[model samples]
Target: MPTPTRITPDSLRAAARTVLERDGRDGLTMQAVATALGVRAPSLYKHVRDRDDLVRVVVDDVSRELGDRLDVALADAGADAATAVRALAEVARRFAHEHPQGYALVFGPLPGSASPDRAALDHGAAALLEAARRLVGEEHALKAARTLTAWMHGFTSMELVGAFRLGGEVDAAWSYGLERIVAGLAADGRGRAG
Candidate 1:
């Protein structure tokens, strides 16, 4: 295999993403990525420092993708908090549907407190928090943000892995629940009980 002469950070990240989409987290490796890019393993070192580092980059890539989608959804949602909330949920579901492995990479636990690459984590959290602030008011945004994160994350995680396989009208249930949560926020600044 021949290594391409034009190597760049963005190109490396693109290769990493391709490996992720084709192979999931477990299948990703310095060797695998190099192989995908038609380069030697050592050459990958120039782009991705180590396995952990590469994972962080890949995870950040997916997180940023989700963030961008949610950002647009929230903005398009306008003043309709219910629409905003539902849009968030739909984006999560779509993420799981389109990128289940990537979703797992973000939501799944690491073996230890490897102290996630702080920059990536902050970027991901900031995106979520910003969307929350936009959808709801500042006063209730914090709590609503927590609710939105937990609910959407859990619900979509379950949906992707078939935890909701016994489904019959699950979408309806999700919609109803989202509306009630929005109403609660609008009414008394609280999340509806699951």
Candidate 2:
């Protein structure tokens, strides 16, 4: 077969994402991406070193995508820092619900040693921290961001697996929980002020 010349890292990532969306993480193999690209599996090695490299690229791409979405949400939130922070959480939750496997990969274990993917993760994280810093002040920004990330990840992960079996509405619970956390942070700020 003639060598496929149009394949790029973004295209490979796109193929991986398609497989991830349709077949879960386990199905994102180099061969699968090659098949998706209508090329031989070895053809992928020119762009990616191996399976781990492919995953790293995909993770970086997806992390950047999530960061872009969060940035848009934050920008749309205007001057209300509290609302902006809450919007970050809500956007993260929506992203998780919309792409469970992709979310899992973003939050999942690394294939090997860290690479440029860490920067992508950091970029995604910094957006949340900056929003949190705006809301809770620099002194408490990291803690606040960590708290928000924990709640968002923990709650969304549970919700994804049908872990919330109670009769109460999950969305209501999520909103209430997020409100309490945001309120507590505000109260904490006030407490420190006085």
Candidate 3:
């Protein structure tokens, strides 16, 4: 008789996420994930091709989750473009803070040629583009999205590393930066619309 399957891709990814969160990227090994799932390291190869493949799985999952949260935040942000932008940024920041390792994995450089799920990554990008479209019209939406993502990524990366050693209400600094970007985008939209 064939042996019963013990681990699914979902379970493997879940265990991998736990390992990543607890031990950071370097600690996320096949053995670690297998241990978390109560399986042997070799057993993980049945689900994932290798360690890089495993990381990609986790990355894809995190990307999808971030996209879902961004979508929900956008939905609840009302009709104001600025508010929508703020909501999206806040959601991203909170996600980063809550899942620093996962956030890094999603945003960090990938190993080898492995890529995260394109659809999953695009879900979040689409949400950002929608917000940007509202703020700056279709012509400039892509630029706005890129700009906002760059800012958010930089800020969160720094925050994650505790690089903001200047030490004066980091929350306020985040608000200040976000407001400036929103205002600038709104002004650009107005200027372009005129």
The best candidate in terms of TM-score: 3
Question: What are the C-alpha RMSDs, in order, of all predicted structures?
Answer: 3.7, 1.7, 2.1
TM-score on alpha carbons, each prediction: 0.82, 0.93, 0.95
lDDT of each: 0.73, 0.85, 0.91
lDDT of 3 by residue, 1-194 (tens): 75645898788878999999999999999999888988779988878898889988998899988999999999999899999999999999999999999999888889775588788889868788999999999999999999999999999999989999976999999999999999999999999999
lDDT for 191 (candidate 2):
75
In the range 1-194, model 2's lDDT, one tens digit per residue, is: 76556897678888889888778888888988889888889998989888888778878887998999899988899887789988999999999988898898888877574244677988788778888887788899999899989888999999999999977999999999999988988778677766
After superposition, candidate 3 runs with Cα above 4 Å error: 1-5
Better structure of 2 and 3 per lDDT: 3
Candidate 1: regions farther than 4 A off: 1-5, 111-119, 134-136, 190-194
lDDT of 1 by residue, 1-194 (tens): 65465667777778887888798888888888888777788997877668888887777777777777877877787776666677777777887788888888888876443235666666666645665665566766778778877887787777666687675887887787777766766555333222
TM-score quality measure for candidate 1: 0.82
List clashing residue pairs in candidate 1. Answer: none
Best by lDDT: 3
Deviation in Å, model 3, residue 184 alpha carbon? 0.2
